[model samples]
Target: MEPMIWRQAEQALAGLLAARFTKDIIRKAEERMRADVHGTLPRWISAWQRLPQTGSLDLEATRQTSAVVVSNAEPIDLEPLTRLLMEFHPWRKGPFEIFGTRIDTEWRSDWKWNRMAEKLEFRGKKILDVGCGNGYYGWKMLAEGADFVLGCDPFLLYVMQFEVFRKYAPQPHRHFVLPLGDTDLPDRMQCFDLCLSMGVLYHRSGPIDHLQKMHGTLKPGGQLLLETLVIESDQPAVLVPKGRYAKMRNVWFIPSVAMLEIWLERTGFEDIRILDVSTTTEEEQRRTPWMTFESLADFLDPQDPRKTVEGYPAPRRAMLLAVARK
Candidate 1:
């Protein structure tokens, strides 16, 4: 399969990369994608491309539920579309609607969007989303009136998920989902007007370095929106889970909101604001038809909802907004 992001590099980035700094960022992004394809990636790409080419794809995306509706189509072939989409299983982020097929993902995702949307203004901004699963929020960002959105995630399935939507959506050039992560980002490129890292901080073994990378990606005075799992506490504290938090083996540092503020200050981010802090609910994340797997419900302790099955504090997320220091 041809590289999924090549067309975006050629078409969408025409005038956007006139600046030398941004051009190099794009160049490194391309190199990373080329170097990373492996395992079931080729199969996933083929399945995505094989999806029926339908016309009259009126792409109406919304901030509510992160749903992208493809209406006014010429009799969408749902059976084959379902078959092809299922090839890339375990859909985590979106709750997208393609030709009336509601992909009820594992995470309602829109719940998080609703909490953060009021605090953020995406209009006319060049945005970068770290760990952007399936570009769901990227679409929401576009709907919020973003000029351009670039999402980077190491997950190949999520990249394929974006391709499935792009095949039918109009003005897809405005959004591009790259197969990369926070560590892979170009150092201090200072390209984007806004940089967002959601549900990613805990996964990083090196939280301080992750903060630095996020800080480096932003232009001076650019806004950085961070959402992460945090432990509730009075004093400054961080939970380095001995084994796993919520059955997720890779989770490392989950800090209190107070600790996070200090970390952001230390990392050279200014004007920090804590937007919202809410514990994730079962309604917000549960096993769905589209993502039929163990979910937040499975991760929680049966006796007490506030604790995980592993007995850690149940997932509580915090949305933080900060300005990149000049």
Candidate 2:
């Protein structure tokens, strides 16, 4: 073969090897996640779909009387999420443990789900956490005496992450990544007392599809816990350059609380209630935008009065929490 051709062939083989290695690593990570979760909650765990799911709560239904019911996906063994933190964040060494056994660390301090937890009564009731990132809220529900708590997300990486953390901070009856939708949920669906979804809708390609899917999962009288980012002013929602959701460009920023209320009604979620409305702090502004990697910073200092030139403006950092019943 010609030398040039041989060199090109070598380059192609190297690229293939790199891709294969990355894929294998991801696969191993997933297997590790499944193994940890199944190891901890073997009796309570079971996959609803063919895919491997993860979380700490038992998803089996237990005579739920709410409008929505929770169920488990298939069971598997996986590693603890805490171990990953230790491996990745060894620089900040400590006895690193879960902040609240009731809630995982990610959703606890900043998001303030504990405030909402005050109004919710999950004892002996079934709860479904849609888009249950790291299974934190589901852990909270289970800790609060929920009969069954299921945490569902479509992302494999998230399910894996949930499984990893679950071992160190085990909760009862929370299943993860069991892809629930209208058709699958309707079949053999159990009713639930309450359902929760947070920090999820914005990432969706079709938020309405997910909402409808959750509606099918609910029983005739179950409550839905909902939260998302919203636009406060009447002006159009802008897509920040290099924003995380900007890649998909499917994020719809509702300008008013009334708009969200109307959409819920249209989707057959009645008794719609706006639970809380709050603006982002300057620090939050910096961190969230930094997550997008959009700018250098939100401001020079967290307390800076000016929205940082390098960070997302405060107006673009609004969040909303609401609830309704089907």
* Model 2 local distance difference test score: 0.44
After superposing candidate 2 on the true structure, give the runs of residues whose Cα lies further than 4 Å from its correct spot: 1-84, 87-111, 168-190, 234-250, 253-255, 282-326
Candidate 1 weakest ten by summed lDDT: 56-65
- In model 2, the Cα lDDT at residue 22 comes to 30
CA lDDT, every prediction? 0.83, 0.44
Stretches of model 1 off by over 4 angstroms after superposition: 2-4, 14-37, 56-66
Tens-digit lDDT track for model 2 on 1-326? 01132233233223323445334433443443353544532322332121223332232321121111222343332234223333322111011133211111211222444447666678887677776654555655655677666565654444544544444333322333343322233321435567676656555556667676666556677777777666564544433325433223445443355565665666658877666666544333332210333322433335653433334333333233334453
For model 1, how does the per-residue alpha-carbon lDDT over 1-326 read when each residue is reduced to its tens digit?
55646756556765554456456656666665553546677678679668766743343445444576655446777888888888978888878887777888898888888888888889999999999989888888887789998888988778778878777666557888877788777677677899999999999999999999999888899999999999999778999999988999999999999999999999999899999999999999999878888999889999999999998899999999999999
In angstroms, how far off is 237's CA in candidate 2?
9.0
Q: Assess candidate 1 and give its lDDT.
A: 0.83
